[model samples]
Target: MRTTPLLVAAPLAVALALLPVMLVASGAQQVGLWSPWTAAPALATGVALAAVLLPRLDLPRLPWPSALLLLALCAGLGTWAALTHGEHLVVRRDPGAYATYALALARYGGVPLDPGLDVFGLPASDPWVRVGAAANYAVPGTGADGSATLLVSPQFLVGVPALLSGAWLVGGWSGLLVAPAVVAALALAAFAGLAAQLLGARWALLATALLGVSQPVVLVARQTFSEPFSLLYLLTAATLLVLAAASRGQRARLPALVAGLLLGAHLLVRIDAVRELVLLVPLVALLAGRRHPAAGPLAVGTLLTGVPAALATRWWDSPYVASVASSLGPLVAAGAVVTVLSAAALLLGRRVARRWDTTGVPRAAVRAAALLPAVAAATVALVGVGLASRPLWLVDSREPYLPGMEQFVGALQQQQGLPVDGLRTYAEDSVVWLVWWLGPVTVLLALVASVVLAAVGTRAVLSRQPLPRWLLPVVVGLAVTVLSLYRPAITPDHPWADRRYVTVTYPYLVLAATATLAWLVGTGRRGTRPAAAVLAAAMLLPTALATLPLATARTETGQVAAVGAVCAALEDAGPRPAVLAVGFRARVEWAPVVRARCGVPFVGIEEPSAPAGTTLGQVLGDAAATARAGGYAPVVLVGDLTSAQTVADATGVTLPPVVSLRTTEPERLLEERPLETREMTVDAWLAPLP
Candidate 1:
């Protein structure tokens, strides 16, 4: 019994389309149908597109049950993570720059900043949303006082936040964990689908599963980070590239546009993807079976997508410096070198093209296929030479391209100390170190596959019975990917390395691995089961690794028990005016401490700098003004004699004497007094003195 490729393609396509929405839904649902149906425009768009191109529906048939299982797995893994892993209803708004934006949100709207937070208030922390939120807030017009302003742009609300927003809607904001984890899960499933498409069914699932719960992917996605969206973007971009490569004429253009858009959107969120952008161009050209010259125009179009993001990057930290600072001199030079060599190769291909004018497509394609290793090797060697710690010619260009990068490099060097071991030691310990150290096995595997496939896939394309678009890019993209990872930017010896950087490479890496398997097993119906099985196994490892540890009872019993009791009691009590943190340390789960959960805004603090800011003085002034508005000095002033003596002299009312708040520590302070009119009855705050 054999299933047609279209049998898998059409419904898998629908599953790909429904993915984000189902992933976004939290574990709980009151009116589940309306919630998902209302938000999933992507699904509708896919349906509509498929309907419009219904004739193309003639192309492939899908195994409906397998497709259903694949879709379910996304929701399953997501729900598992949401219910079991990561923080819930916790506020950890630390005082960093990200905190500042969270504060600005607090100072202005008080809407929860991240997806994990219930749309109701701050609780869940998501870095993916945080970075974008910062960029959004950076654009100014951040809601004016009172009369309802559209400060947070819904336009930017796609990907993780949009997904998490669904979780927030269903389970409340504290449960936004449900949405992103779901996205992560579905993203893995998509990985499986792509694998099935490019590599065969088993490895497709294998790659998807590996990525879904892989230590770093799960860890970052569980937090308030952008990598989940990055994963999605990479998947979409890689897919489009694959589509464009496999299809001919106008059939490829739409997907190419999609790939370009995803690439552009990716750069906007995390500006570190210029390397991937560089590689996407030629790979797409090679994959499309178009002549190198024809591919040139598409490459330009793809790059043009980044222009909006480049403009934003310039806005972010000053453009003149970002370009150079971002490049890290040697990497830029290497990129330049690759561009020149590749261009020369393309130009030379003209002679080959002319010579083979009647010689036939296969020979021309083999010639083009021949270019893969040269470009790949050039890319790899560039990383090896340029990205190391030793200073080079790039030091001159550092002033413009990357103003802060060299300074960061200097700081890393100074901190690293005399022995080069310091450099190695630091690199090994950082997230960059972890991935690069471990990534080689996978990368090498992918690299070998990419090189072979680039040659093979190119040959096939030239023969005019080409492999799919996605497969070709996977080869070249992986070729470039392995090379890019070797650079110092990801080496941690450089300042640019981070845990999330791998998101840029994930799509191609998986695709290459998938392509390898596809080549090995063949993409015909005969290979589907084994391919699916392989993907399943790869997924379980990471998913278990990511989900199990978090599910285990790790929280201190006292904190958990106390928070649970408090939350239950609070729910029962409903909107009481009780100040949450009374005189401090009220419970083992201290109110202020619990209040400091990640992604929650600083509620009680005031900003001292910039216009319309607030301070302790301003707070008191506002209180005094409130008193004046009521036709008398209504605020009860209370404190120590230093302040009591001063207040006695200034205002007619004498402030009360102060006393030690902690009997153990003389340094600790407190004050109390009675209000004439019960002014702002905040007990922990010094009682107004008479």
Candidate 2:
């Protein structure tokens, strides 16, 4: 009655592959068309299923040609992402800064200001204060004599700018758009390789496939953001650290050093990654020291790489320092400080271990030391709770873009007559929402895996046993879970996937979930494997369904598109330098985009209000006069009809239409109401001369 593993897995593989086809067919039927492109997902699902199952089932390895074809199919999808929808729609000024940074870095070797660039309504002497502030400065500084001496870069890091600079150098503006895609592709490949090393090929392929389709990957990969680089460096560091632990002799030392370098370098990619260093340094120290005396090398490597980045950040005066101080409570910040100090103490004591000729400290002591940071982090987080305490839920959760603290506290909404509930309810709903978006089945498996792995690591440490192979992953998973759990405000928006807070840990999560599912299915049992395969297939669909739009969307569907159309129109309006007057609502974002896209000098016109004793027309007239005086010819103004009418009424001049673009449609994708619009007809006209 003996049966081969391949024989047992064949029916399950076939069954799992067919499930996606059925889902796709059903989806197509509901839409009433079976287009060729629609079939691609089903085919991809089948191929991915085979890729995961065949080797695990001990089937004959596919020959080189088949392997190459499969590899090409996967790689092709990763590459196409850069071409089709790589640039996610820009909704705020921050995104535009990436282009500015790229251009600045390429030309100036830093983000130093270029006053000659058509930024801040060039040649307008009024300071265009609104425009100035958005550009991170105040125009015409109110210095005692009214000289503009002050400019600011705001609370931002230069990581993304630094990366974009290289792209600008390579292919100029267009290359900047393509840069994120390249970084994303590399990240996917690296993630797959890391997964294979830690969780085996089956898990690796599954995680890689999921990441390729994940909304976060699709959106962030093409946009000028620091997250992609952060993920790449984080994954690389973890991989190197894992290899160092698994190897011996000098082999381990090199990886340990390299691992430290990558981890330290990660700071330059994303400042937020400092949070991970708290856990990573201590974990690497313990794990690498298990079989070999590599802890010293790891510590030294981390210090050597980390110190310069820290010093540079201090010298640059991180824009985020103020924000972090304001947003993060004292206790939370203190806990983070304590965590770093603890890791440093452990590393320094590792040297002391050599002095004492000790194998290691007692197991109880080691476990207690490791637990110190987590305990402190949790206890200190309470201060934040007290500072912003409110009912967990409110009846009228009307705003889609409410602040995180408000969502958690519900105090403001409650004061305004919305019903509210206590903290217990909020905590419960947050947990459920997280599980729902992450996939109920996947979350269940991950939970089981985390608990089991954590217990094993704890027991091994406390009982003085050889370090378990699973300890590194356990530490990583715990860190991610703890970080995610602390964020009280929970939003389950599909495109943004608010639960994607722990994206850095996504690879480890997939490994944990996949390993648990594999064990549950009992690979040796022929009958149960099919059931496990079905369950595994089901978990992936929800995420794909939710994130597919995000993966495919290059630009938002509503206001952003309309605004882009206007910018494109401005671009087509010829090479003449014009002082385009934009309405207040549009100016915050439009000014930046128009300046970058249309290469036009822009004037920000205030709405429904003007400086005291100065009429709206006088302001418009002055802006136009200044631009014309500064040599900008055929001065043109672009704004909503109301703002245009305001200029016409105040100046008592006839307005001639240059062009007019439509109002942004209601209910558009990715529109943040506070910063964007769905109302207001935008018009461009020849400015009436003073």
Q: Provide the RMSD of all predictions against the true structure, rounded to 1 decimal.
A: 12.8, 12.5
- Pick out the ten consecutive residues of candidate 2 with the lowest summed lDDT: 666-675
In candidate 2, the residue pairs with backbone N, CA or C atoms under 3 Å apart (3 or more residues apart, or in different chains) clash, namely 141-148, 155-319
lDDT per residue as tens, model 1, 1-690: 344444234433543444323222211111122244555564576456545543442232236555555556556656655554443222221111222222222222222222211221222121111212212221112222332222222112223343444454456434444455655664565555556656555555556555554444544545445566566666655655555566666666555654565565555444445666666545644543344222544565556556655553343443223334545445556667777766676667666777778776675667776676466555544443444332333221113132233454455456545322222323223323333322433444455555565555545544545554555455545544444444424323311233434464655655555555555555567767696456544434433543444333211113223334443433333232121111111211122222222222112212223454433443434444543443332222222334434344443554332222311100100011101111111111122312
User: How does candidate 1 fare on TM-score?
Assistant: 0.55
The most accurate candidate by lDDT is 2
* Cα error, candidate 1, residue 275 (Å): 4.3
Clashes of 1: 44
* The 10-residue segment with the lowest total lDDT in model 1: 665-674
Question: Can you give the lDDT of residue 121 in candidate 2?
Answer: 36
TM-score for each candidate, following the candidate numbering = 0.55, 0.69
